[model samples]
Target: MTQPNILELAKQGDAKAIALLLNRQLQPKGITATAALKDGCLQVILEAVEVPSQQVLAAYMSKSIAGLGAASIEKVKVYGRQTGTKVPAWNQEFEMAGQKLPVADVSETRSAISTEVTESKPLSLKERAKLGDVEAIASLLNIPLRNKGISATASLQDGCLQVMLEGDPVPEEELAVRVVRRELTSLKAGAIASVKVYGQQVGEDFPAWNREFEIVAQTQTVKQNNNVKLNNHNHTLGDSIESDGLQEIAKNGDLNAIAILIQKSLAAYEVHVDAEIQYGVMLWLKLKSDKTLDSQACLNRVSRILNNIQPDKIVSARISQINSKNPKQQAWNKYLAFKEGQFIDNTKAVNQMTGAFCAAVVIVLIFISVMYKPTSTTSSSPASSSSTPASSSTSNSTTPRTFLGKSQTGYELWADKNCVYVKGMTEGDLARLNTDVWRFKDEVKLQTGYKCVLFE
Candidate 1:
């Protein structure tokens, strides 16, 4: 269809037609209706004319409004970060300063007020690199506790740490924000890493300043000692200890310490670990105790993370045994022993297990294919069958051959013989069909396949 006609149809709430027009216009420009939808103009139109918010569908159409209306947004100070329902499609009605407002309205208000504003906290090298401020983040690292006096500013240069004083004076402060990028296993001494100084202002008092530093670590840095001391004086495991400046503690089978350390390390960055740190801690304990499985730990961790984080961030992992003494292997061994004690042969059970494993593999492959598909298979496919049956002679002769598909009544599917039988009709189609409701004026006996046959 033409651009003007498409725009008109969109204004009339024909989402599919609007989408079609948008796609046609954007295809030549190497874009999709999804792209137009991202910019918000088309999406706002669709939403205003359409019934509900089509944000997800708008995203599908590529109509994103990134940084759109961000400048005029205001902050809605949340208490303890527990602002609203954590569930998706969740809604709550509450009184806000004596006015009742829906949670969705609150969310929309929040979004509109804080457009394009990121939640990046201020980090200063001078405060972090202080004599006792080991919690300071040189770049953008998370610290377990808050830095009360930590002060620094950062700026993105040719992508390196650049240090400056708070008052924009000299290079007195040696605290630098440096970015380091390397594989975890290859980290060693004398590695040149990329970094950035975040010299943004905080509150209304402090001016913008930057402090930069660089790590001398190199790729392929071997762990010479088992007791390694972290930069913040935290004693770590697998370190033999250092004699001069720092000390490392050694332990054997201390499950509590091991669990705590594993939890702390794993949970340090939420973005990195797929499993909860608590789960990691439990898994570590199970491994240390030579237990059969970490299922209990896994479930506990899942519960904790689910309670803590928003619904969108919840994730799961499927672990497999790579070692002979792997936990899963041990679990299977225990299961076999228990069954044997009960005088039951595990051969049949093992065969069933094998069948399940094969089925699981096939399911995983199919799931991956669907997830990685180029186009969305979740959306409705185009209708190929027309309602204008070639043999329906009593149907409105003057009306266009537009098909109004079947009508669904609960579990029962109903289709008018004249409309070629379909389920559920769109509002537009319903309105048109209502005008033709008088056409089947007389009752007629229909074949078993037909709802009712009309007699002239």
Candidate 2:
């Protein structure tokens, strides 16, 4: 009469009896035997009937299990043992069975789940500084860091800003010095004061994400005012160059002016530049300094500005600077002497210089390529080219090329004429098409594509 009674009957291996009972069904239209079978009632019926493929009986066995009645089970808290240790265990109050329970008494196969209590060991700024968190170091100096109000969020730690978050979206162990550098750059540039550090906790199966605070050192307005006076003096000189022109400027190589300019540049702080760009620009600049131009934070800042202005232009300017004042003076004198010729076209001289340099480079490359010609001595060897066709054939036959939709197949990678054909398909053309397809797909998915590559 009831579902459980029917279940009991099915358990007794009554396929015919079960079918007969179902034939006398009295339930809603939405409920069906087939639905019950799909919902795993058929297996139960098979056991009851002691016969597999009693499809009709099994099919009729399923329906809303609410008819079977409610479960008797209720949640209970199994308490943990307290050892009265001094280390304040971070625990929280919990609720079970409509009753508040102390965390100490709550337990099961896993520790109690609840909100975090305050940390027992509050770190002093000095102690946090030793952890190499730069922001923490700044904090020790009484710097005020901005807080976004997310606990376990990243904050200042010490000499380096340490991300102390647990369970980050990214794996914690993969974090490296580059990340530290990036955060430091942001701190230096006043972008972010702190970040979340992610890591796994001891004796835990899952990772934890934690927040840290940022504290940066600040200069008193008075100090900034004094620096501004010196900055104004140097800035006037830079502005002077605009009106007076580079020609009228006397060349004493005023060390004081240069030093002031360098210092102000460092303090003024411009766009953020990463280490690689810093290194490359420094190499190209070939600065006349025993002062270690490659490093020194001032140069790093200047390099960032130079890069922002235009990396290629900066590189070209530096190359032009080689031979120091001699080439500069010569070029300036030549320009003055040949003022009429200079205006023939705006880029006439620069274009001539660039063309000359290109010609020289082409000559060198051609010489090297000829000397190292592929056929210079390799003709006697078995043609490696002969085996390429076989491998290509196998690749063509077995490659699991996916159609992957419109986003997978279209692009003009590089432009030219006449492309090599693959099985009557132009390989280069297809490659371009594939790149376009991927770009379109990435655009649709908000994903990055190789063809749509971006760099900073």
Candidate 3:
């Protein structure tokens, strides 16, 4: 019998037909199995040793039932039989055949699956960034900015940058304001044009508005030369230090030069100076006040001196009193979790395997079975004119409707008024296509994990 006839017979609860179909589908994938229609589901029993992971087996069964177009089959329950175990260790249910099956509440199974999936492939920085990786990006940004008393966190949403700086007992307002300004100015000219900076003292819900600033690409001009000069202003730090051309070096965007210049100028304050580039074109200068020095006073003096030296060249400049109590420690635990060349989405991997299996079944069945055709019956009637005109007359309109077609990648493609659908396509393939062919549309959720739809 043809594959369609066999599938139709299986729907009628013919055990032989169901077994034959299951064997035909599963055997080629190295899964020796038997199936029967029972209790409104396709009950599949697999040889324990032949069964792989539950997720892999679930995906295979889902794709197989979908291929058969068996709407009567509500779900698929898989059980594995081992030599010694009295009860099967592998028992899982998967929704199929248009049925709204309840999600399995197997927490232990899910936890084990998650651990297996995550440990198999840890995410790298580049891979995570491509997926808009939130945790990885935040960890990377926080690593360089960690210091005594102050901590910085970074988050990116839709390519917009948000940086939050927190200090215990709050830093001097003047210092916070300068730091926020410098950071924003530097980021505005980089690849990240939109930036929001927030500063808050530890234990506060709201940020200090006076210490906040925003920068957008449209309002800012890109500095062509890194050596742009800062405006000179009168300061209490004496003319001798001012005449040393510290402002000129700050304008050069040289972190080492800027750090040396600031250190020499503030040596009298007995502060420890450190500097680093926070982001593109933005430099961070940190000054730790000694016990004998008044932290707030030293911050004020540094802010005034730095603010005038490179006001225009610097994107932002801040001088803040680092919190003495419970300073936040920088730990890039997430970044460290990144293992190079080892990022894998378990779902996507399973989907690809399932798609390949389905595609193979489709190709094989197409060659073995005749294409299914609907039967049509007709009867001749005499004296149709005497009957009602409406009964005899037929409408001849043919509305345009979307139908499945073949894609270059061997996926089945269909487009409706709202979205484009594809079967046998993996998420990775969909992502690559989204960047090229499906650039303007977003993906729509699909009931079948093996299929994907892009919204028009």
The TM-scores, one per candidate, come to: 0.17, 0.17, 0.21
lDDT of 3 by residue, 1-456 (tens): 111233455555544455555544343333345566767777877543223467666655555554454556777788865422236667888777554433332211233223332212354332343355544434333322332345666677655667677777664454444444444343233434455657688889988643333443222111122322222333334353334433333533545446656665555554456676554534455665433344333443444445434432354443333323312211100100001111111333433554565455546555553454322234434443233332122222122225445555456555544445554554345445522222212222322222345421
Off by over 4 Å in 2: 1-160, 164-301, 304-456
Error of 2 at 80 (Å): 43
> How big is the positional error of residue 336 in model 3, measured in Å on the Cα after superposition?
41
Question: CA shift at 17, candidate 2, in angstroms?
Answer: 80
**Global lDDT of model 2:** 0.27
All candidates: CA RMSD in angstroms? 30.0, 29.5, 33.8
Report the number of backbone clashes for model 1.
53
Query: Which one is best on lDDT?
Result: 3
Q: Give the TM-score of candidate 2.
A: 0.17
The whole-model lDDT of each prediction reads 0.27, 0.27, 0.44
In candidate 3, what residue range of length 10 has the lowest lDDT sum? 330-339
| Residue 294 alpha-carbon offset, candidate 1, angstroms | 20
In candidate 2 the C-alpha lDDT for residue 224 amounts to 30
lDDT, model 1, position 260: 38
